[model samples]
Target: MAELTTLARPYAKAVFDAAKDQDAIDLWDQALAFAAQVAANEQVKVILAKPGLAEQRKAQLLADCFEEQLPEALSNFLSILAENNRLALLPAISELFSLYRADLERTVKMQVSTAFEMTAEQQQKLIDALSRKLERKVELESSVDQSLIGGVVIRTGDLVIDASVRGKLAKMANAVGS
Candidate 1:
């Protein structure tokens, strides 16, 4: 079997290209979300994997589920995946599509985990700081992790800034132990 990323890349690229051509990135985004939802449903997964089910029937099921809401291109893409028995790759395809969109938009998604919830002012401050550091627009997703004790941990793609109290304390403990 191919790796999930390998399986998803071509699908993502195809959707991205189609969306770019149509000037309907949002439409592709919606389709990817819907596809991911369908792929995640256990019943749908079972039906997709059923040995006796024909490809045409699977395509019909997908069409019936999404034909009204999805664009023709997206519907056709879904049907192609059904025909190819690759419906399970939808989640990864969605993720890859998001990455492609973010790249095109010059936006970065950052995850900021703090010991406590931050005020809007603080969140904006962090965003500003990240924008300066990364030199790009930052879209932050914030969460509270009480285990941090205090301070924030920022994760942007391959970079992670661990400024949490727990991390500092661990470093100090290691220094003392040494």
Candidate 2:
């Protein structure tokens, strides 16, 4: 995981820069996502791993897999990856590129897990508060886990706020132990 991130950073940055210059952030996002999906398939992974497969074949196969949906520029980008034998890094590159896109758009993704469904008003209020607190456009994602018993667990990037009943119980147990 770390090695893939290290190897993919430059490529992702380069693609992001190109997208910025072209005013095509969302366009590149869609293209990279499509390419990443192709690269992640089991049969495609096997094909990419074959040393005997020529670069042309690999590029063609990927382009065909996308049903030629790739723009000319992205098609060329795929050729570059093929030439550099970095096709396997597409998934990491896509993930990193999305981070770049989010940063450029001044957006942060937040996830909330709760024991019960959050009302639309409550979700909106939380999003509003989080936007003000984080100083970024908040994209709220949420799920319900009945085992949470009550309250919520919120996560954004590396930060987590564990306010669930289970979390409180664990903290209480720790305090008693201490």
Candidate 3:
């Protein structure tokens, strides 16, 4: 995974820079995501991995999967990846591109897990607080996890806030043991 990400970083950066210059960051983001999904299909994987296939043919296969014609820049990007035998790296490229886009847009995506479903008011309040604290736009994905027992656990990238009842008990247990 690490190696694939390392290999994909340059491609992702190049695509992101192009998108930025074209004022089409969001459009490229979506296009890359769609291309990644197509590349991940099992049949597509087999086709892409065929040693005898021409790079242009492989790229055309991907382009044909789209309902609409791809922008010329993205089509060329796909051709480069196919020529380099790097179609397998599309998922990593898409993920890296999203990270770059998020950084540029000053947005953070967080996952919040709670013992119970959150009310809209509660979710909004949390988003408001996190936005003020992180000083960035917050995008929240909420889920119910009964194992939490109560409260919530919020995660965004490398940061985690564990306020759940289960987490507090574990901390207390560690403190007493120490």
RMSD of each: 2.2, 1.3, 1.4
In order of appearance, the predictions have TM-scores of 0.89, 0.94, 0.93
Best by TM-score: 2
Per residue, candidate 2 scores C-alpha lDDT tens digits across 1-178 of 9999999999999999999999998889988898899899999999999999998789889898775577888889889999999999999999999999989889999999999999999999999998999899999999999998999999987899999999999999999999
- Top of the candidates by lDDT: 3
lDDT of 3 by residue, 27-83 (tens): 999999999999999999999889998988999999998999888998999989988
Off by over 4 Å in 3: 175-178
By lDDT: ranked, best first: 3, 2, 1
Error of 2 at 87 (Å): 0.5
What's the candidate order when arranged by decreasing TM-score? 2, 3, 1
Q: Candidate 1 on 22-54: residue-level lDDT in tens?
A: 999977887788778877789988998888989
Candidate 2 displacement at residue 68 in angstroms: 3.7
Candidate-wise lDDT, in order = 0.87, 0.92, 0.95
Model 2 — which ten-residue stretch has the worst lDDT? 64-73
Q: What residue pairs are clashing in model 3? A: none
Local error of candidate 1 at residue 118 (angstroms) = 1.4
> Distance (Å) between predicted and true CA of 154, model 2?
1.1
